[model samples]
Target: MTDVVVPATGYVIISASPDFSCPDSRRYYRDKGIMQGKTVIYGDIISAEERRAMKKGFAGKLANLVWRRDKTLFAPDESCAAVFVDLDDPRFANPEFLVSLATAGEQVRVIGKSDRNDIQDTIKVSKLGVAEVLTSEQCLTRLHDLLNEVEEIATASEHRDTRYTIDALIGSSPQIKEIRKTIRLLAEVDFPSALILGETGSGKSLVSRILHNTGLRGKHNLVEVNCSAIPDELFESELFGHVKGAFTDAKNEKTGLFEFAQEGTLFLDEVGNLSPSAQAKLLKVLEDKKLRKVGSVEEKDISVRVVAATNVDLHEAIRAGQFREDLYFRLNLLTIEIPPLRQRPEDIRDLIEYYLNQFAVLYNKGTIRFSENAIEDMTAYAWPGNIRELCNVVERAVLLTHRDEITAKDIRSALKRGRITAAERRQLTIELPPQGVSLEDVQAQVIKRVLDMFNWNKTEAARYLQISRPRLRRIIQAAGLEQNRRRP
Candidate 1:
């Protein structure tokens, strides 16, 4: 007999035989050896026919019944033991035993074995203890309980996937590196209610996720709610939950974001967009860690780490009286201010390379690289929309790159179609002055401006001037342009 660890003290023999159709039995077989384990519901059911078969060897002996390793059912020196269960047993109706086993594989132990006999091998069950029989109605009542539990476990797991993966945080810039280090340091503390202030597309939501996934409650819930996305009428119901019939359309009771994020993290994206009333309600929740469901008298005391993000300036909003000052202070516990992409201009190249590689493999394209001019143009314009804009640019370039290298023409074409507004365009003019700045100085400025304008193109700038690479190099050296116009 194979050894099976007991999860709970019930149902020792789970039906192993495919033929046995007992709904309660987990597996079915004869148990070998002495009663060496814990006291629980267990035994081998020896049917009357099998008992008759035990007396004399026959063509239809228990050996015929055994279906394991190729040995006769039992040795001549061994005697088989048997216990018989009724066709109907009450224990099958109770759910406490089955649910624990099915979910955690806890609260039960079961096994199976078979012995040789002469008359005929038949099915049986051994009852180890007395249990009240549950009616067929009872079993039917909770028939789907186990399946529901399994499904819920699966869905919850899916909803809460990826608490902390570094890939989710998008950059390798020095600023990003510093943020990473800060997160590592903060993971050691109990800092609560952090505010992630930044422009849109600056990856505030991503940073919130990083904090939740890497912090103390990594194994717990990390629920996200978009404040701006929730309708005004339903804001309370969405965040603090609502009782059935709380409003005209509130036909059924509903759980809210606070309940879902209890004892874990609540990422309120666009928290600054909350209306005046919502702001008040949210402030109350933050102060008291308690919320009363709409149309209900009862209140729930919650414990959650609040992480709020916003594209709007809360300080400005507060000055304009659009946001509450007290609430702003509450949310500003450990503020992380993410500058717009244009401000952290040094990071564009790395982001370009990262996103290009990501999209190239995703779109099943050959290896791709940005031409010098293409890189320059990207860096030149102020990315008002920041990394988010860069991402869109890179994605489009990867899809449209006919050649392996993404050239200036491709970028200009994409931009011409409105990747950027015409008003934002700044053309690089590399003319040497008549009595102007030294040729070297002019070359340096021209190259730097062109690099920033076209996003850093050696060839495009050279071509624009109708010059060759060697000649361009001499001019670059004479002008000391290399020190000023390199792309990191």
Candidate 2:
């Protein structure tokens, strides 16, 4: 007899085995009589209430599940559940094909007729990611251990919700309001793919999480991969897992990011930085809905939502032949562009208030506030690093300011680091020969030129050189430009 149990306060039993008299399956019997005031008829009379409870208890979370059945060609969609299959059934002829194909969070265990099953068949199926190839004789001892593992992982994942929601994208500006609305709408449907465009540090990662955590598949894993960080040589192996002995160093079988994110969202950050070959491989998988491991011939069907984020302009990248045009179109289906913090200056105060409160609570600084003039000064500055820069400035002020109220002077002091104009940066540029020159020599000459240009007024020279006063002093002392300082 095959049986499955999904537990709520109690357990909901589902028995799929054809023969209840089969003595081998009797090992699963926990008791002879009723359990939790319900008759245990070996998968008979599973009450509607128990089923409802089972479904409700684990809503948006991984449920403790077990399914044992005769071998068949079917894939289960139980995210992170476990299944047992009888490999002695006629379906065992093609052992590779009989290995269970599981969704994002599921494992398959196969029970063969004997302990010494065909070595070749075992090797082939194991490489296909079968959780275990065991004999029916082994089930009595191993089932308990496998179930324990599933329960532990499920319990551990209970705390995995993204702390961000649509509200976490805090701002009252029209742009902010619209973005929130867009995220909420996106959360209601299962879109195949989406593209997030924005400047660096403009909260693309936050938006991606909000998109995943609030969406239909939020309960499943949200696997994130940084496209720019993965080496081109290992892109395929990293994203689509390889079997054991696939490569010299591939010591064990591996599961790729896509498999980990099965039936969930895969956030590919900095997607525009993918190499041309990697882009082609990604596009093929996206179109075919299947991926073959780097060294394996078998292809696994994939069901993952792809959400890609990038600061690079893909249109320019396509024109420059740096990115795939087809891949761009695939990802651009549903797009959200985050406006840079400078363009949405109205949101600056709201951000300041939010971050200030967060930092205050974190550092146990009670009831500190930014002065009106301080907020005004910050609202007027062009934040080159966007919201990320604003966060740093707020954290710095909170840590450095001594009083309860931060004044305009404190804000100014925190923001005093040099701001270089494009033209000024151009002015500091110099040509280097094929044989690279010393970096220190170049820096020394640039500092000397800026000092002489500003007539050695340290404040003006510091501003012109785009560095702090203390840093400028250090450069002066190190480069021996102290003597050239204009005398008071």
Candidate 3:
């Protein structure tokens, strides 16, 4: 007899015997509230073809399947959660079939008719990875325990899968490795505030997220605020939200960033950009751990970890009397400095490969690669704008390149064209080889020299050379002088 129960609002009971008995089993399950209702199927009345079809239809729907001396009714697949095998069944003697039934992530139980020791010995010798071995009398209790255990394991695994860890920050350089270790250690502690300092495109925001997601407060909300972007007039209202009718335009009560991040983390990016008044107000909140809504008398207590990031030099700002020294000290309890892309050139190849594979999939372009010379040029260039610049360069190259492999010329063109800014130009000085350069080489050098003189400011460079920006780009592309444009 095999009993398969598909858990829904009710239980579906499929039985192979004509009588379709097991009053005790039904009553035990019902009393335990495992099933609200039951559906019984009599295999004796149903044809073998019908039986096979029924089993196939219910293969994935079954929550539990118990096979007792029945070989004709069992169907196991990846979706089956649990299966119980009776040793008394002649089919159970096939160890290979029993092993196949216990697929990965599925639990299998073997029950012996009378000898519990024999079942244990069989399980040990068979190396079946059976979850349990018991006599027929112990089946009910053991089965109940197994179900609970499986539920708990599933819940834990699901939670683990959703979390963000330091591994997500992809780089293998020593600096990055050390940063990962520090992040892991910081997550273990309950630090109130930490300061992350890095160049504009060096992933300070990513580190902040990793800190919040891996910490003790990971289950709570993580609110981020770009301090530099918020207008001075609205800064207070945005950070410490306003009550209805607080100001002329106030419409309804609003939750503040600090309050919204209660029991979690509040990431303040570009913290040095906060106005003096805003800085003082924020300092008071950090000291008191409370904030009153704009135009409200009542104050609410807040408990949130503060993680602040900045590309600015706060020490210089403090000396210039722009930033508050006390607030800086408070936020700098633990400081982490993210190294710029230029300083960690060794990781550039990995980063390029990573983003190439990523954007290839994103754009549905199959397997993109860079020429050896292109890789060499990329690694040699100073990524002044850091990872952001590299990302833009790679994205543009992937979009524009027609061939499977991005050439050196393609990379140079992308890097030079993408980074041009309207700025003062820098003069270039080049020395010709003793053997003397080719006419084409000299022309390339002269065009490159003029472009560099204009700081790759395409408009200014073209104006100085008396050509259009598009025409200048084409000329630079033709001469293979694009490499010189990114130097400054």
Model 2 per-residue lDDT tens digits across residues 231-308? 666678778888988987577677787876788778899899889999999999999999998779999999999999
Q: For residues 1-488, what per-residue lDDT tens digits would candidate 1 score against the true structure? A: 11111111111111111111222222322133111212221222333443343323122222312222221223323332221122232343123433332222212222222233211111122122211122232222122222222233234323433324555566667787788888888787767789998877788877877787667755445666667545566577767878898887566686776776666678888888889998998999899888999999998898889999987868799999999999998998898888777666678878888888877764567667898788886776566556767787787777667788988777766554444433333323345557766655665665665544454566876776678867777877776766665342
State which candidate has the highest TM-score.
Answer: 3
RMSD of each: 22.6, 17.9, 22.5
The runs of at least 3 residues in candidate 1 whose Cα sits more than 4 Å from the true structure, single-residue gaps closed, are 1-164, 167-172, 418-488
User: Candidate 3, which ten residues in sequence have the lowest lDDT sum?
Assistant: 9-18
Cα-based lDDT at residue 460, candidate 2: 86
Alpha-carbon error at 432 in model 3, in Å? 28
The local distance difference test score of model 2 is 0.64
What range of 10 consecutive residues in model 2 has the weakest lDDT sum?
33-42
Q: How would you encode candidate 3's per-residue C-alpha lDDT over 1-488 as one tens digit per residue?
A: 11223211000011111111345644543343233211111112223543453344344432444333344433443233444555445555466655554433323222222234463455342344333344543554334334333343334423342224777687889999999999989888988999999877778987987888788877565777777645566567767888999997566676777876788788899899889999999999999999999999998999999999998889999999999999999999999999887678888998889789866754556877988778887887666566877887897798678899998889877866786333312323244889887887777766765664455678987898787889888877887776555542
As for TM-score, the candidate ahead, 2 or 3, is: 3
User: For residue 78, what is the lDDT in candidate 3?
Assistant: 25
Better of 1 and 3 by lDDT: 3
Clashing pairs in 2: 80-105
